[model samples]
Target: MRQDELWGEDTTQRYDTPGTGMFAPDVVEPAVHRLAELADGGRALEFAIGTGRIAVPLARHGVPVTGIELSQPMIAQLRSKTDEATIPVVVGDMATASAPGPFHLVYLVFNTISNLLTQPEQVECFRNAARHLIPGGRFVIELHVPDLRKLPPGQHAVVFTSGPGYLGVDTYDPLHQHLTSHHFHYTEDGQARLARSPHRYIWPAELDLMGQLAGFELESRHADWKGGEFTAESGSHVSVYRLGPVTAT
Candidate 1:
């Protein structure tokens, strides 16, 4: 599907449902705290800042936050919450868009880098973040580790999430490292609605290589924003990369 079609009006409208699931206080606090600490009273820029989910709150914490977003509908949803002066945003692709910056932190959270859908684009995303950062500045990414181990031999799909009213599955093309996440939300009357998005899944080591190519060095990697250990069984990670050299804190 086209990028615009993927995050168009209807998706933007339904994107935010505060204080539940991924929007829960507990789920958001760790990321906010960690990013705030990284910002260290300097400026921050968010890549693909949808509906200001993190940007709004981060700005309220006193960090000057700017964003680059491609979807106007999503930006409208954000503007409904605050004005441009509060949190400025540029409309364009994250991999190529330049936000006026020499920011201390440039973050792409919630697996947004996967939205680029190609290895070259993903690498460009790293370079874009580097371009916006000051020396010793940080670029962060929160993403899932492709769970290929869960896929039985010859099986191309796996159900990653299911709940009372929703189900989510991922289909993989191992040869190309491509993935498509399929989500279904059920109505009370038993009808199901579906949405799908494509992604190019990269391994953690591959991401580090991209960062290195973009003039960043791996600073730290955690299984979560809370600084949990990333291990063989961990399914996701929060990785920090720094421009030039940084002594890990």
Candidate 2:
């Protein structure tokens, strides 16, 4: 499915899980705190600011926020929580859409960058973030490390989560660095539903190279929002890259 269709009405309806999963105070607060610190009281821009999950709270924390999102349905959901005057959003692709900026901070969280599904697009995403940031501003991303190590010889799929009501699996294309995540949800009424999304998994070093190509320097990388150590064993990371000062010839 196309990116917009994948996050269409049905997905948008089920996207917000209040006080649970990603919405848990423990999960949300730390991220908000870190982002607020990065914003440093200046304006912030969120790439793919779905449903105001972090933007709303970050704005409430006193940083003015603007957003870029492709899904109109998702934007509709976000509007229910806050008005445009409070948090303006430009509707279009994060890799190419321009929002009002020179923002102090630009962020893309929860592996959203992988949605670009191709190397060129992902590179453009980095450039887009750079375009919106002021000199020395930061661009933050939270993404998962590919689980290729978990796959034994000849295995192409891995089960990342298995629980009473849900099952999540990822199938990989090692040659292309592509992945398709399948999520199965079982209702108490014995109904089952499946949702799948495609992604282009990226390595940390590769991501750093993208940052460099976009004129950014790696500032910090942590296992989580709380500044935990990022080791080889870490499954995901929150990486911060800072744009360098612009110079004239």
- Clashes (backbone N, CA, C under 3 Å), per candidate, total 0, 0
lDDT of 2 by residue, 107-206 (tens): 9999999999999999999999999988899999999998798999999999999999999999999999999999999999999999999999999999
TM-score of each: 0.97, 0.97
Residue-level lDDT for 167 in candidate 1: 98
Q: What C-alpha lDDT do the candidate models reach, one value each?
A: 0.93, 0.95
- Best candidate, TM-score: 1
Residue-wise lDDT of candidate 1 within 112-191, one digit each (tens)?
A: 99988889999999999999999999999999999999898999999998999899999999999999999999999999
**Which residue pairs in candidate 1 have backbone atoms (N, alpha carbon, C) closer than 3 angstroms, thus clashing?**
none
* Model 2 alpha-carbon miss at residue 19, Å: 0.6
Q: What is the lDDT of residue 160 in candidate 1?
A: 92
> Model 1, 150: alpha-carbon shift in Å?
0.7
